[model samples]
Target: INGARLIMVATPANAHGDIAEQLAPFLKDDQIIMLNPGRTLGTHYFYNLLEKNGLKANVIVAEADTLIYTCRLVKNGLCRVFSLKKELHVAAHNPDDTQMVCELLSEFYDVIVPAESVLETGLSNLGVIFHPVPVILNIARIEEQSTFSHYKQGISPTVATFLEKIDNERIAIANALGVKVDTAVKWLNRIYRTEGDTLYEALQNNVAYTEVLAPTTIHTRYIYEDIQTGLVPLSILSKELGIENSAMDCVIRLASMLYNYDFYLNGRNEGIIDFQKIINSRKVAISR
Candidate 1:
């Protein structure tokens, strides 16, 4: 109903802010807009849109500390939750609304923590941005194989270091943007319900992240799932936020170069015959 007090938007990371922008005009002054999984720019985008559109509605961009902790079933336009959170942490444009929003969410969720700000909840995200790079770069060898199991694969020590690097960069970026980030690594372990202090330690210590991987070397879904969708969103977010970063740019550039090689090889085998053109075009742009 247009009279709804709370509006929740769940879309891809890149699309959430825009969706909120379009919905701003329809929202009542007291209505709360929540973006599930605000990844990075979710709050900034929504705030910018409200200012740009001259909307006076109270907007809150809330992020799930863990990815929607429920087994949900959708049928006949109804969502059934087998398990739901007891509490949720919410960050809003106005810190004063935290309690009110928490009270509203308490109807569906068991608990709601009033985070000092939305940035706190946003930075505490355990999934998308932080877990992508290690899954991709570390599994490059397996991605060339015929088949592989993604979820079951174990993380190598070297790859663990990479993940830490990415996590550090993310935290630094968040701080630079005036967003106080909680311990991202520690939060990841907490969400996973593991004993390790960080994802790296969890991978090494926890029996789950170290499950027996598939024997076959075929491509795993991790690359596309985490790298393409997850990491790409983070890179884009960092750029938009004007966060100082060279490590992420390097990783992205390396991935692009590797993808170019794949494209060239596939084209050669398929008689696509335009490899030189691709190189020339990119070179011209670089020269520009």
Candidate 2:
């Protein structure tokens, strides 16, 4: 790993803290560690883990809202790339450093647009918005090993309506943090270059996601990882920012009940969130 200036962390979101723990000692100052599509607040977990390890490295950490590609594995060491995103939203732990990281990343991806900060990137997470609800709504199919499309068949009109309220809560939290985030449908349009009047229609029209199917089992990362890591953090920040996220809360509670686990207490922990910074963010936002 010598002479490596950048490390791309593409592991499952739940494993980020553990991976950070192991990679902490080897990271050099000025090196950059990027969480390729940190579900929600992944940079915080990475930055805090490194800091707590006393690495004192001047490394830059960044994250994206979603993966740059719609991809799936064909087999061991082989993968299928379905569609390359037209746009990808990104940000760093330190927002000021985002542009530099974006410049470096543009060489690989089609586009890397700077987000306001890691906070914005985290809140803008599309997976967190898309993954859990559909799985819960279709738990029977997921559990029974019934075959269906994740976006096409899974996200029904009812599920789409439910997700609309959840997405609204997310937008409210973003507003509370003084960050602007597009709603899920608008985000879909932005990234996929697809046009639709509604989210379900847009998702149905997006051929890139059409090939993706539902999980064979209920015990999948869509609920296990997304709720624990993604919704948990969003729930925390929403409560902290005083946004009433009942839909988000209900999802978390149901996931915890179904899985018999407390995601909030068990979710990624390296003491990363630094409540003072959040308070400062509130102050700055209010001032503006």
Candidate 3:
């Protein structure tokens, strides 16, 4: 990597708010801030918070369709670039300087699709639809058994149909909320560089989903915190806009239940999930 003037972040959506808050102080007015995957309101929230806190930096937020690549640290300061994305869309909040930011980025990136606004680019988040179902549905199965791979379960015709239906509901909710979202299948292919039409079709070529599902770790990061912080608030916003579709409703309710369960567990000083504060912060969104 070159001596870049700015660095964008790509972490789980739940971490966006906290990271943005912490990073504001280190940045200067001439520097830029970018969220590689702008989980709803992430950039704007950081920008506003920085302005309110008296930080004068120029923040630039972009939303690529997918991470554009998967990265894992192999050693200290060395991350393996497991993949490379072909093209991506990006935008800046300041409409006047959007083109300038995109032009600057194009020097490092091969293809940069300049978007109308950061909001338009941010709304195209792939994680929004793909992340929730497997964890929640698997949790239901884990309640029935100690260990289970929902991926194997998802391959069944019945469960696959359920996923498809639920995905449609996610898209509907996004549309109703005026968030730009595409089919999960499309994003998967774009990110994975696959020829398949759907995620299931792509799965046929790889056994990871079937054989090696996500570990059944009892961490609060993915299941409880993610939904409470990211999905539930978005879902509530969607519902308020009259998008009370069944699947979205179910997902939201499940997150709410899990969040409450997390509180009860933490109250007893039990092994708790992290990001509990995120769940508590939902009071603000829920009350709106």
Candidate 4:
């Protein structure tokens, strides 16, 4: 166990803390743990857990903007690789170590770009933009077991308009926190190698989204986890940063009604992060 140098965690956002807890006993000082596609500031959760456990592991924790490979397991132990992401974003809790981590990661991935910090990597997560809204908007089609493609046909103009608002709030939160990030449209274009004048067009024309199937029920993670992890934090950050996040709030409320669960009380934003401190510490970490 002592020989471990880096560990990449690619679990559901909700399971990250649990996994970190399990690994706390084995993790040694200076080990690297990276959260693949940290939906909403997930690195903070992992870092905080290690500290709370009193592990004294000087771990280099980091997170990615999204998973490197878009893939599915067609069968047990069988995976189908979709498109490898063209651009990958990552940052460490310590900004000075970000380049080292990215260089190490680049050995495994063709592209590993440094974000401002983990804040930028976490905020850059497109899961908040991509997963929830279209599922909610196409509930009828989903419930009816329609074969509509999740991205190509599911995201109509109406869905795109709603996504735009969510992206706006996301951008606003980043701006308020003094980080630069992308709108969903611009991000999608870059991620999918698509040329589009609009978000809907970008999605529809993107080959990566072709044949993507819609979720079949409201019980899916697209709603549950996205609301709990994605929209919840966006709404929380919007409130903190004094931005209007009506669309995000409305989505949370609607999801609560649909599933009859109190997402706010059960969401991930309960002192899960002191983002400003994380940023400020990065400055100190880099200056040393």
- The best candidate in terms of lDDT: 2
Q: Candidate 4, residues 78-102: lDDT per residue as tens digits?
A: 9899778777889887778889999
**lDDT (CA) for every model shown?**
0.54, 0.81, 0.55, 0.79
For model 3, residues 109-215, the per-residue Cα lDDT tens digits are 87787776554564455444545566665664545445655455534545455556666766765565444666766655655554566566754544444554443
lDDT order of candidates, best first?
2, 4, 3, 1
- TM value for model 2: 0.91
User: Candidate 1 at 233: error in angstroms?
Assistant: 9.0
- Tell me the deviation in Å of residue 251 in model 3: 1.8
Looking at model 1, residue 120 earns an lDDT score of: 61
> Which candidate tops TM-score?
2
Residue runs of model 3 more than 4 Å from their true location after superposition:
1-4, 52-54, 75-78, 140-158, 173-181, 186-212, 220-230, 259-288
Q: What range of 10 consecutive residues in model 3 has the weakest lDDT sum?
A: 266-275
Per-residue lDDT tens digits for candidate 1, residues 112-138, read 677766556655654544444544554
What lDDT does candidate 4 reach at residue 183?
Answer: 83
For model 2, how does the per-residue alpha-carbon lDDT over 90-136 read when each residue is reduced to its tens digit?
A: 88888888999998898887688888787778888777778989998
TM for every model, in the order presented, reads 0.64, 0.91, 0.69, 0.90
